[model samples]
Target: MHFTRPRDLVVAGLVALAFVYVAFKFAYGSMPRLPTLAGATLIVLAVIEALLAFSIRARIRQRRVTSALAVVRAVALAKASSMLGALMLGAWLGVLAALLPRVGDLAAATGDVRSALVGTPSAIVLIAAGLWLEYCCRTPEGGDRKHDDHPTG
Candidate 1:
């Protein structure tokens, strides 16, 4: 499978943002506040993944421990999670954009916008962590001759 691209994730997020914003603009429905607890949970997940990435990389390089299958699985999971985070961030940004203008006019819009602001950064942190994980999963130099050790940006 191809590696995850930053452009792809940005496009996905932009699309979601537009779709969500349009829906909110038309007042078809409103999204609930993003939970602070969910943000905390995501932060924890990012920390764990970041630590795992470093640990796995060290193990594979030192030859003290190695598991190609495990690394592959981790890479897959990282890609998926990063993409998901990007998608959610775009949606949250869109929601905030849509709500900011209406916050003063509408009583509840303020709270919704506030939550979106909070959640957007949290999602960004998750994306960064996932990308780091993907980077760590790359094979060390000499492991792959067809391509260098550097990962696809």
Candidate 2:
């Protein structure tokens, strides 16, 4: 899979922000409050992916791929991470945009905005982690590929 394009993410976030801001303007009272743990959970995921990326890249760079299965697994993780990061980034931006103007005026908006603010950075971290993972899959310059005579099972 290819690395995510920044422009696409930016466009997605903009569209989501516009949509959510309008919807929240009318539904703020009825909408449920943002969960406080959301940010923490995303942060945890981001950290996990970041560490995983670093470890996997190190192995790849060293030409120490253990098996075909492992590389396949890493590829799958990279694909999933990139997609999730993009989606979460857009969603969080949307909610944050809605809450911006109302932060001090309403208690719900205030709390929700805080969570969104926390989530935004975490989501960005996830994106960075995902992209790093994708980059790790590429063979380094001048690396030998003699062992890859056959695709790993």
Candidate 3:
């Protein structure tokens, strides 16, 4: 789960590459509306995912939490991030499904479906990378804890 790990870095790199590729494809109209929508949703999700990953990294670097309360705060933040991610993903897919068929051009429709299928794996990769980053940030090391000291005392 460590962000510094080679596997994690590879995954992150792959996800980033896929994001760029999909973005470019969508922009040039190589991707249809449905896939484009999915890609767009994935892009947004990726951003959130990256932020969560960064937060995890920060938490780990800060290592300022040994108590149950700190654990609770971390868990709560992780849960909220997860919930938001899941909801957004669901909504994105739902919206895409609802709108895709209504648009004309069967070929374009098929293209969108294909893009979604291809892009989904990449999206999953991105999510996993983000989660991994979060895991990395939650360290057991006590050295990083500084906020535990009350400044006013």
Name the candidate that leads on lDDT.
1
Error of 1 at 23 (Å): 1.9
Candidate 2 lDDT over 44-72, as tens digits, reads: 77678778778887887787878857766
| Candidate 1 whole-model C-alpha lDDT, 0 to 1 | 0.79
Per-residue lDDT of model 1, residues 38-146, tens digit only: 5546677788889988998788778755567898999998998799888888888888888899888987787677777777888898899899898777667744434
Each prediction's RMSD to truth: 3.6, 5.2, 12.2
Q: Whole-model lDDT for model 2 versus the true structure? A: 0.74
What TM-score does each of the candidates earn? Answer: 0.84, 0.79, 0.39
**Model 3: per-residue lDDT, tens digit, 1-153?**
112233543444455445544553355355325444454555555566566567556665676445646544544544444434444443334434533663475556556555555555545544554455446455556432444433242
Candidate 3 lDDT trough over 10 residues, lowest sum: 1-10
For model 2 the local lDDT of residue 89 reads 77
Ranking by TM-score: 1, 2, 3
Q: Which candidate has the top score in TM-score?
A: 1
Better of 1 and 3 by TM-score: 1
Q: Local distance difference test, per candidate?
A: 0.79, 0.74, 0.49
Clashes of 3: 3
